[model samples]
Every structure is written in C-alpha cells, then in structure tokens.
Target: MYTFIISIILLVAGYFTYGKYIEKMFGVKEERATPAYVNQDGVDYLPMSSNKNSLIQLLNIAGVGPIFGPIMGALYGPVAFIWIVLGCIFAGAVHDYLTGMISIRNRGAHLPELAGKFLGKVMKHVVNAFAILLLILVGTVFVTSPASLLHNLMNGKVSLLIITLFIFGYYILATLLPIDKIIGRFYPIFGALLLVASLGVGGMLIIQQVPIPELTLANLHPDQMPIFPLLFLTITCGALSGFHATQTPIISRTTQTEKQGRKIFYGMMIAEGIIAMVWAAAAMSLFQGANGLNELLATGGTGLVVSEVAKVTLGAVVGTLAVLGVIVLPITSGDTAFRSARMIIADYIKLPQFSMKKRLLIAVPLFVISIALTQIDFNILWRYFSWANQATAAIALFVGAMYLFIARKNYWVALIPGAFILYTTTVYILNAEIGFRQSLNVSYVAGAVISVVLVILFFKAAQKSRAAELSLEVDISDYRNIAS
Candidate 1:
C-alpha cells in the first residue's frame, strides 16, 4: 500500500520536476506560432484548448493497454509497481513529450516523417510501413474486444457482427471528420468516465484497506517467466509504449502552444500511470495472491478479472459504469488508431487532407485492410502488435535522442532509455515464438551486440546532422555579412 501511494506521488512529482525540465530542455518558444494556427486546415490541424487537448490526449493513448497490461503485470507481484513508476517517468512520459513536441516543431509531422528526418530516410520508409501496420492491428484488435463486450453487455440481443460493423462505421466517421467534431467533443466525457472508474477503484481499495502487498523484487509469476523483457512488454502503455508515438502526432496538430505539451503529453501519461497503478493494486489485492491471479487469468483472462474487481470494489451500479468506461477506452483508441493511420498515409502521399475526396482516398483502403485483418486470430495479431509496438517506441526514442543531440541538449535523457528499450525489444523478439526462438542467453548476447551497433550508428547520424546544421548556420552568417 505504501509502495502504491509513494509511486503515485512520484508520478505526480515527476510532472512538476522532470516534465518541466524536459520542456525547458526542448526549448519551448512561447511566442512562436503553432501548427494549429499556422496550418488551420479544419480537418486535422485545428486549435484546441489545453483542457480539451489534455482530455483528448488522455483518451487517445489511455486505451485498454494500461488496464489490461497492468492487470497481467500484477502476476509479477509488486515488482510491477517499480516498472510503472520508473518506466513512466524516465521512458514513457519522455517518449510522449518528445514525440509530440518534435512533431509540433515540424508542423505536426507524423512519426514516420520525423523518424525519417531525424533517424534516416530508410527509417522513414521502415517506420511508415511499420506504423501503418501497427495502427491497423491496433484498430482491428481494439474493435473485437469492445464489440464482444458490448455484445455480452447486451446479452447477445445484438449480434457480434452488427456490433463490430457499427464500431467500424463509427471509426470511419471519426477518421474522416474534423478533429473537433466527434473526437474533441465526445472524448472529454469519455475521459471523465475513465477517470471516475480508475479513481473510484483506487479510492475504494484504500478506503476498504485492501491489503495490497508492499513492493518486492520477487518474480512471483506462476510460470516464473523472466521479468526483464516480458514484464516490460507486458506492461507497456502504463509504463513506456511506442504506440503513444503514433497517437501523439494527432494531438500535436491540435496543440495551441508549446507550453501545453507538458500537460497534454507528459501529464496525460502520468495520469495513465496512475490508472495502471490502480488496476495493478486492485488485481494484486483482490485476487488473494499471484497464484490466484494467474489461475483467474488462465481461465478467463484480464477482461473477467476487470469485471470481477470492479463489481466487488465499486459495487453493482458503479461497477457496471466502470466497465462501460473500460469499454470506452478501446473504442476511443481504435477510432484514433484509424484516424492516425489516415493521417500517416495522407502525410506520406503528400495529399492535402482538407478535401473530403482526398481524405477518403487514404482512409478507405486503410479501413478495408483493417476489416480484413479482423479475420485473423486476436492472439496472433496481438503477438505481432506487441513486438511492433515496442520496436516503434525504440525507434521513436532514438529519433528523440537524435533531435536532442543535433540541438546540443542533454541527449542522454532520451538516449539511455531509448537504448534500453531497444535492447529489451530486440531480446524479446529473438527469444519469443514469433521470432528466431533462440535461447534467452543467446538473445541477451545478440541483443546487446545489436544495440551497441545501433547506438554507434545513431551517434554517427547525429554527428552528421549536427555538422549539416552548423554548416547551414555558418553559410547564413556569411550571407548576412555579405548583405551588410
């Protein structure tokens, strides 16, 4: 219990201290115009209030990952709390803030464009393909869960096919419409429900004095899976997730100022960490122990655990509302996942999004692909999504590091975590069934070698980029002297 409370305090304190420090390091220019005003296309780049942007950003990235992931992470005992706090502070929030602010500086360019610009042109193509595929998978995977839940809630009065089609239809509308229309207006309410649900569960746990175990380094997994990469991957959104990179650019376009980046990007991630901490605590305390939680997970998965926890803690009426809030999570993220995909494609093709025809040109095929992907098994899609998601994060962190290095800021802020996640993701794929299926020791050695080579390459690229910028500045100075 003390661990959970201190962790929450640490996350909040991180915002005022580390969040502000990062903002300053990025050199926020208050007087400068933002993309929202400079590129007011009415479709994607529309000015929005910090409050609205915060809520929208919260819902955008706070999908079921935080809830489901942490619930699963609880199987690792209180050690999961350590990852939530440290990862959220050093890695997750930093990743989100840098990605969003960098996009804002680049006129709200999506991750692929930024990755290409900072990392390399090759990365641009790689990330473009990678991000689009991941978003589609996210959209498709999110669709099934919510549709099934809604179907269950309605007790099959509505067919699953109909629920899914309706969700896909809504995704189309949300994707094609202007940002302020459906998403901006509805998200605040959805965000409220999400907060209420999370806070309610957390509050009741404390009020009832649920005996949440104190923090420990024990690996309490019933299967005794190693905690290194799997735990990191298992609990992503609440800690550090690459998926947030794709979402951040969406809000990047709508931000009214550089200052709001802290609140909208960094602050919302902390809020998510809090949500994750709550769910983790609830799962740990309510389930009796790691063994009980594992048994429940094996039988019914996290969804059943969530329902049971909410009903038991918050009671029947509010529990139902809390579950609905959870339902809203994936729906909101799914819409934006499709929306982000549309924007990425539009940005890639250099198509103007102002025109409805142009928007459909990109959005139509994306949805078609997403629909087809729904036919694939959910577990298989998630396995790929999980790896792709972290890989994207590693790339984004490297982009942030490159940006910082070029700007001559403290690049280590991004570099250290970037390299660590890069190494972890590499190790994961190498050992997992999806990849080479190598032994863990082989994965560690190979992942270390790969990461070191990549870090060296990153430094070389940063040096080249820095030298290019320096040359341009010198040329400009000489031209000014000539003009004088």
Candidate 2:
C-alpha cells in the first residue's frame, strides 16, 4: 500500500517539477504562434480549446491499452506497480512530451516528417512505411475487438458483421469530419465514463477490503516469462508506446500555444499512468490476490479478464455501463488510427484535405485495406501490432535523442531511454515469438553489443550535428506552414 500510494504521488508531483523542466529544456516559447492558429484551413489544422485537446489526446492514447495491458502485467505480480509509476515519470511521459513538442516546433509535422528531419532521409522513408502499416493494424484491431465485445455483451443479438460495419462507419465519419464537429465533441463524454469506471473500481476495492498484492521482486508468472523485458513489452501502453507518437501529431496540429504541450501531452500521459495503476490494483484485489490473477489469466484472454473484472467489481447496470465505457476505449482509438493514417497519406501525396472530395480520395482506399485486414485472426494481428508498436517507439525515442543532440542540449533524457528500449526490443525480436528464435543467452549478448554501438553512434552524431547544423541542404522552415 505504501509503495503504491507513494508511486502515485511521485507521478503527480513529477508534472510540476520534471514536466515543467522538460518544457523549458525544449525551449517552449509563449509568443510563438502555433500551427493551429497560423495554418487554420478549417480542416486538419485548426485551433481547439486546450481542455478539448487534453480529452482527445487522452482517449486517443488511452483506448483499452492502459486497462488491458496492465491486466496482463498483473500476472507477473505486483511488480507492475513499480514499472507503471517509474516508467511513466521517467520514460513514457518524457517520450510523449518531447515528441509532441518537437512536432509543434516543426509546424505540426507528423512522426515520419519529424523522423526525417532529425534522422536521415532513409530513416524517414522507413518510418513512413512503418507508420502507415502500424496505423492500419491498430485501426483494424481496435475495430474488430470492440465490435466483437459488443457482440458478446449483447449475447449475439446483433450480428458481428452488422456491428463491425456500424463501427467501421463511425471510423470513416470521424476520419473525414473536422476535429471539433465529431471527435472533440464526443470524446469528453467517453473520457468521463472511462475515468469513472477506473475510479469506481478503485473505490470498491478499498471499501470491500480486498487483499491488495504485496510489492515484491519475486517472479510469480506461471509461464516463467522473464520480467526484465517481457514485463516492459506486456505493459507497453501504460509505460511507453510508439503508438502514442503517431497520435501526438493529431493533437499537435490543434495546440494553440507551445506552453500547453506539457499539460496536453505530458500531463495526459501521467493521467493515463494513474488509470493504469487503478485498474492493476482493482484486477488483483477483485481476484482475491495476484496468484489468483495468474490462474485466471492462464485460463482466459485479455478481453475475458477485463470483462470479468468489470462485471465482478462494478456489478449490475453500472457494470454494464463500465463495460460499455471499455468498448468506447478501442472504438475511439480505431477511428483515430485511420485519422492519423489519413494525415500521413495527405502529407505523402502532397495533397491538402480542405475539400470533402480530396479527403475521400485519401481515405477510401485506406478503409478498404483496413476492412480486409480485419479478416486476419486477432492473435496474429496483435503479434504484429505488439512488436511493430514498440519498434516504432524505439525509433521515436532515437529520433528524440537526435533532436536533442542537434540542438546541443543535454541528450541523455532521450538517449538513455532510447538505448534501453532499443536493447529490449532487439532482444525480444531475437528470442521471443516473432524474430530469429535464438536462445536468450545469444539474444542478450547481441542486444548488449548493439546497444553499446548505438550509444556510441548517438554521441558521434551529436558532434557531427554541431559541425553540420548550419550547412544542411534541407531548410524545412521555409515552407513549414504551407506544407505538412
């Protein structure tokens, strides 16, 4: 209890202290006009209330990730609490803030453009392909998951095909409409239900006096998954995810001032960190204990555990409401994945999105691709999504380090996390289900060597960036506003 309580306090306090420090370190200026106001075309780039931006950013990133991921992480026992609290403060929130601020500074550029600016053109091209594929996977996965859950909750009253079409229709509408009309208006209510559900579970746990799992380093996982890296991957969204970087540009185009970046970006991540903690505790307590949770998880899937937890904790109509709120989590994210995909496509083809016809030209094909992707099994989609998601994050973290190095500010903030994540993802690929299938020992040795080399490259690049800053061929600032 003491560990959990202190961790929460540290994260909230981190906002005023570390969050503000990062904002200053990145050179946020009050007088600089943001893209939303400077490049308003009444479409993608338009000014919105800071409050609305915060809510959209929250739902855009949160989805079912914080709830579902943490529920799986709990199978590893109470160690998840430590990871969520510390990871959010030092890594996740930092990643989200810096990436968003970087986008703002570059005239609200998306991740591919930002990556191209900081990294080289080759990386830019690679990330462009990566960003599109990942978004499609995310969009399709979120669509099917929610539609299927709604199907189950209704006890098959609604056909899955009909429900999926309805959900996909929502995605198309949200993707095409102006920000304020659909997403900005509806997200707040969905965000409220999400917060209420998580908070209600927390309160019920305390009132019922359920046994909260004790904090320990002991591995309680029945599958014996190593905690060093698997925990990091399993708890991807709550701790750090590359997916958040893709979403950042969506809100980036709407920010009114650079000053709001910390609150809108960093502050929302910390709020998500809290939501993760609340669900982790509730899942453990409601199952009687962490050991019980591992047993339950072993027998079921993420969606199963989440539905059971909500039904058992909230109960009756409120439980149903909470489950509906959970449904909103994925549906919100799925639509925005397409929205982000649309922005990427517009930028790629050098097309503007002011007219409905132009927007359809970009979106029509993207939806067709997503609809086909939904046919692949969920487990396969998730495997690709999991690795692709973290791989993107590792790349984003490296891109951030490059930004810091080019500016000649302290680069350690991004560099350290970059290397750690790089090492973990590399090791996971080499040994886990997806990659080379090498032994763990081989993965560890190779990962360590590569990580060290990457660190060395970062420093060398910083020195070269110092020498090359004024002579770069691309002067992106010349048309930053008129372009993406």
Candidate 3:
C-alpha cells in the first residue's frame, strides 16, 4: 500500500521536477509557433487546446498494455512499483518527450524521419519499415483484441466477425477523415471511459482497504522468469514502450506550442504510469496476492482475468461498463495505429494527404492487410508484437540519445534506457520459448555484452550526428546553448 501510494505521489513530483527540467533542457519556447499553427491542414495537422491534446495523448499511448501489462507484472510482486515509478520518470516519459519534441522541431516528422535525421540514412529506411510493421501489428492486434473481448461479453451472441468489421470500419473512417472530425472528437469520450474504469477499480481497492503486497525483491514469476529482463519485457507498455514514440508524432503536429510538449508528452506518460501502478496493485490485491494472480493467469490468460476481475471487483452492470471501458483501450489505440499507418505511408512516399482519395489509396490496403492479420491466433501474433513494440522503443531511445548528443545535452537521459531495452529485447529474442532457445546463462551473458556494445554505438552515433546536424542545417544550437 505504501509502495502504491508513494509511487503515485512520486510521479506527480517527477513532473514538476524532472519533467520541467527536461522540458527546459529541450528548450521548449513559448515564442515558437508549432507545426499545427504553421501548417494547419485541418486533416491531420490542426491545432487544439492543450486540455484535449493531453487527453488524446493519454488515450493514444494508454492501450490495454498498461492495464494488461501491469496486471501481469504484478505477479512479479511489488517490484512492479519500482519499475513503474522510476521507469516512467527517467526512461519512458523522457523517451516520449524527446521523440515527440523532436517531431515537433522537425515540422512533425515521424519516427522514421527522426531516426533518419539523427541515426543516418541507412537507419532511416530500416526504421521506416520497422515503424510501419510495428504500427500494422499494433492496429491488427488492437482490432482483434477488443472484438474478441466484446464478443465474449455478449456471450458470443454478437459474432467477433461483425464486431471486428464494425471496428475496422471505424478505423477506416477515422483514417480517411480529417483529424478533428472523428478522432479528435470522440477519442476523449473513450478516454473518459478508460479513466472511469481505471478509477473504478482503483477506488474500490481503496474503499475495500485491500492489503497490497509489500515491496519485495522476490522473483514471483511462476516460470521463474528473471526479474530483470522478463519483468521489463512483460511490462513494456506500462513502464516504457517505443510504441508511444510512434503515437508521439500524432500529438506533436496538433500541439499549439512547444511549451505544451512536457504536459502532453511527458505528463501524459506519467499519467499512464499512475494508471499502471493502480491496476498492478488492484490485480494483486483482488487476487489475494501475486501468486494467486499468476495461477489464474496461467489457467485463463489476461482477457479472462480481466473479465473476472472487473465483474468481481466493480459489480455486474458497472463491471460490464468497466470491462467494455477496458475494451476502449485497444479500440481507441488500434484505429490510431491504422491512422498512423496511413500518415506514415504518406510521409514515406511523399504523397499528398489533403484529398480523401489519397488517404484512401494508402488506408484501404492497410486495413485489408490488418483484417487479413486477424485470422492469426492472438497469442502467436502478440509474442511478435510485444517484441516489435519494445524493439521500436529501442530504436527511438537511440534516436533520442543521438538527438541529445547532437544538442550537446545529457544524452545519458535516453542512452541508458535505450541500452537497457536493447539488452532486454536481445535477451528475450535469444531465450524465450518461441525464440532461439538458448540457455538462460548463455543469453544473460550475451545480453550484457550486447548492452555494452549498444552503449558504445550510442557514443558513435552521437559523434556521427554531431557533424550531420551541422550539415543537415536544422537548428540545434538553441538547445545546444541551453545545454551549456
């Protein structure tokens, strides 16, 4: 209980302290007009109030990942608390802010464009494909998840196929239309649903006065998954996801000024961290402890645990609403994934986005591909999706580190986290059941060696971007001057 409460308090404090410092270090200027103001295209790049932007940013990044990931992570005991609090403050929020601000600084450049600018041309193409695949996977996974959940809620009276088509129809419409029309409008309503669901369970825990597991270092994973890499991987979206960086460019374009960057980007991520912490505690508390939670998870998986938990914790009707509210997490995030897929394809090919036909030209094919993907088993697809999500973060972290290095700021802020994520992804890839099937000790040593090499690569890229920054001629000296 102390851990849970203190973690939330620390996140708020993190905002004014580290969040403010990072904002200033990045040199967010009130005087500078954002891309939204500079290139108001009503379609994707339109300005909005900071309040709405904040909510959109929250919902965009807050998928079932936080809710689901932390619930699973809670099985690791209260160590999840440490990861959520420290990871959000130092790693996740910083990753999102830097990437988002970098997008804003570069006239709403997407993640691939940002990587290309800092990491070099070769990486540009690599990350471009990487980001698109991850987004597609996200869109696909997001679609199937909510549809299945909703179908189960209705006792399969409503076919998953119909729910899926209806949802994908929304994604197609949302993708083709102007930003302000569908997404910018109803996303907040969905956002409210997610919040109420989170707070509903959260408030119940408090009212019931359930005893959250005390903070401990014990490795409670039933498989005896290592506390370091597996816990980090299992809890990717909640603590820090490269996935959020993809979503960053969306809000980067809509933001009114650079001054709002910290609030929307950094602050929103902190909000997710709080949401994650609460869910983690509630899952643990409601299960009578992490062990019971893990046993249920082994038998039933995450979705079943979710429905059972919501119905048990919040009552029947409200619980139905809460569970559907949980469904809102994926549906909202999935469409944005498709929306981002369209935007990314347009940006990559340099296609004009003003016309509905042009947007459809890109979006129709993407949605078809996503619908095709729905045929695959969810567990199989998610294993790859999970890796893809963190791998994206690994790249974005490097991009941010490279940007900071070019700016002559403390690149350590991003570099360390990037290196750590790189190690986790590497370790998991080599050692997981679906992976290369290496022994644990072998993978551990390999991950550590690779992690060090990643750090070395960071230094090399920093130096590389130093000369490249001058040649590219994008102004970094304002931030550079601030760094001094």
Candidate 4:
C-alpha cells in the first residue's frame, strides 16, 4: 500500500517536472506560419475543440496494457516496480510525446503516412504492417484478459458466447458514439469508480488481515526460470511499444495546442504507470509465492485476483462490486482497441472513398478475429503482444530522434529519453535468455534490430532534408533579386 501511494506520487511529480521541461523546450504554444496543421475539415485533420483535447488524449492512451502488463510482470516480485517507473518515463512517455507532436506538425497524418513522408514508401509499408499486427495482438490480449476475468467472476458459469456478445455490444457503442461524448461522459465516472474500488479494496485488505508477501529481490526458482522471459516481462511496458505509436497520431490530430501534447501524452503514460503500480501492489498484497499466485489466478483468473483483494479489503459485496469495476475498466479499454483497429483498417482500405457499407464490411472481419482470439488465455497473448509493441516503440524513438535533428539542430535534450530507452531495451535483450534461446520472446532483441534499421533510414532522410533546405534558400535569393 505504501509502495503504491509512493509510486503514484512519484509518477505525478515526474509528470509535472519532466512535462514542464518538454513544454519549455518544444515551445508548442508558438504561433505557426499557417493554421493548416492545426485545423481541418473533418475526416483526417479535425481541429480540437479545447482543453478537452488533453482529456481525450488521456482516455485514448490509458488502457489494459498498463494494468495487466504490470500485474503479470509482478510475478517476479516487487523489484518489477522499478522497471515500470523508469520505463514509463524514459520510453513510453517519450515515444508518445514525440509521436503526438510530429503528427500535429504533419497535418494530422497517421504514423504510416508520416513514415511515408519522412522515411519513404518502403519504410512506411513496413511500419504499417508492424502496426496492424501489433494492434491485432493488443486487441487479442485485451479481449482474452477481460473475458477470462469475466469468466472467473461468474465462477466459469458464464459461457464464452455471452461474454463475446457483451464485448461486441460494448465495441459497437464505442464505434457509434462520438469520441468526445464518450470520453466527456464516461471517463470521470469510470475513473471515480476505479478510485473508490482501489481504496475500498486496500482498506478491506487491512481489516481482513490478508497476508502480505515479503519484499524480496531473491529469485524464485532461479534454475528453472529462463532469464530472457523474465527480462522481457520486466521491461515489457517501458521500452518499445507498437500500439502507442499508432495511437499517438490519433491523439495528435485531436490536440488543441501543440503545447498540450506534453501534458496529455506524457501525463497519461505516467497515469498508466501508477495504475500498473496499484495493480501490482494489489497482487503482491494478496498472494504469497508464484505458485500461490498461479493457483489464485487459475481459480478466479485475473478477475478473482481483484475480487479476492477487494473482498479482503472491503467485504464480499463491495469486493464483488470492485471486481465489476475491474471488469468494466478493461472492457472500456478493449472498446478503444476495437475502435483503433477499425480506424486503421478503414484507412488501409481508403474506405472513405467508398460507401459506409464498404467500411463496415472491412471492419467486421477484424472484430470477429478479436472476438475469436478473446476466448483463449490472455496472458499468453499478452506476452507475444508486448514483444511486437516494443519493436514499434523502437522505430518511433528513431523517428523522433530524426524529427528533433531536422526541426532544431541544437535540441539534443529531446534525444535524452530516446537514448535511455535504446540503452535499457538493448541491455534487456542482451542479458536475458528467451525461451529456447530464440529472439521471439525477447523484445530488446527485436527492438534493437528494428531500431538499427530505422536509424539508418532516419539519417538518410536527414541528409535529403538538408539538401532540400539548401535548394530552397538558393531559390529564395533568386526570387528576391527578381522582386528587387
């Protein structure tokens, strides 16, 4: 409990501190030469309404990854907290901020479009492929985890079919509703419920005398455990995430002020980190060892984990309410995932050029795939999804680094976070031994390979940008002479 509170405080404090630095360094409030970048007609580049942009940005970015990723990582014990805090700041937050700003500058272009503009067609296609795959994996995880939790809550009496119907209904509402209306109404309600549930669960745990696990850096079954998978889980959320890069442009297009990007992007990531900490603390407080934790999860699944924690803290009824809260939170997140997938596929097919019926046709298969995948074990899907997510993050960091160099040659400060992410993810890959000594389970290895290739492409783009700048300067001088 102490650790959770401290983690929240630290994350909030870090947001204000580091966020202010980004605000000052970037000067997002400065007037642009033209408002073309900020304002748009409708489909691709709609102007933001107001400060609510920040809230919308928060709602879009905060999701199940932060919650389940951290809880699952906590299997290694409390030390996992360190990775969550540091990685959120250095990797996740930085990638989000840069991606948002870049998107805003590029006339609300999505990441793939931006990649095509800056990195070239080949790279753009590659990024799009990676992004689509990452979203599928994320959607799969989101569906499976919550469904598993729902199953546990109903004591496995709830058939997968019923859960699927409920999720599809939620996704339909998420799609049909306006993004702003949904967020404006539900975010506060859901957030408040979560706060109450968290507090209630914590309070009940104290009253019920649930056994808190000992804090230790000691390894559990060191010989049996593979080093790679452990490291992969430890650094899961922090390093390179594919899903974040895709969402960055979505929020960027909705931002009112470029200045708000730092607060909305980094602040949300920090909030997610804190949420992860809370769940991790909850898990730690409720279970003793890995085996015990496994048994609890097997019995109640992740849903039971929350229910039992709440029951220990609040009482049976309130605990069940808390479990319900837990289920709703992820379901909300999954809805967004579904929405994002639809948007991506819509863009992929250029369905705006087609009728609305055609767009729905493209969207149906994607939703069906998500629903089918949801029936499986969420934890397994999350493991693979996290790896692909890191790969995208690495590419994004490379892109951000290039943007900084192109926009302001002296702005090396912007690269600090990127450098840290590269270093940590690299270390995580090199030191860890993944399952069967393969790279598939190791995000660092995957991220490193992708990062190296992107870095090469970035430098090539920078060189061409310099040449174009020089040519424009020469043409301007000639035009000035003609005017004189």
**Model 2 regions more than 4 Å off:** 217-223, 288-291, 298-300, 470-484
| Best candidate, TM-score | 1
How close to the true structure is residue 360 of candidate 1, measured as C-alpha lDDT? Answer: 91
Write the residue-wise lDDT of candidate 3 on 1-484 in tens digits: 7777888899999999999999988787676667786667889888888889998899899878898889888887877888888989999999999989989888788999888878878888999899889999989989888887888889989988899889998888877898889888998898888889888887887787778777754534434646867788778777899889889999988988788889999999998998898788888888767668878888867877888778877898998999988898888888788888888889989998999889889988888788788898988888888888898998999988887787788888888888888998999988988898999889999989988977887687677658666432234333211111
Off by over 4 Å in 1: 217-223, 470-484
Ranking by TM-score: 1, 3, 2, 4
Write down the worst ten-residue block by lDDT for model 4: 472-481
Q: Write the per-residue lDDT of candidate 4 for residues 41-157, one digit (tens) a residue.
A: 343335554445554554455556555565666676656666677667666776787777776666555667666655567877887777777777776666666676787778879
lDDT, candidates in the order shown: 0.89, 0.83, 0.84, 0.61
Winner by TM-score between candidate 2 and candidate 1: 1
Candidate 1 per-residue lDDT, tens place, 1-484, comes to 8988999999999999999999998888665677777777888988889999999999999888999999988988888999999999999999999999988888898999998888778999999999999999999989988887788667789999999999999999999999999999999999999999999999999999999989654544434557888999989999999999999999988898887899999999999999999999999999889889989888867778888899999998999899999999999999999999999988898888888998899889988888898899877987898899899999999989988888889999999999999999999999999999999999999999999999998888889899888321111111121110
Which portions of model 4 miss their true places by more than 4 Å? 1-5, 30-55, 156-158, 181-184, 199-229, 232-240, 353-355, 372-379, 409-436, 439-484
lDDT (0-100) at residue 225 of candidate 4?
Answer: 54
lDDT for model 1? 0.89
- Measured by lDDT, the strongest candidate is 1
Question: What TM-score would candidate 3 get against the native?
Answer: 0.94
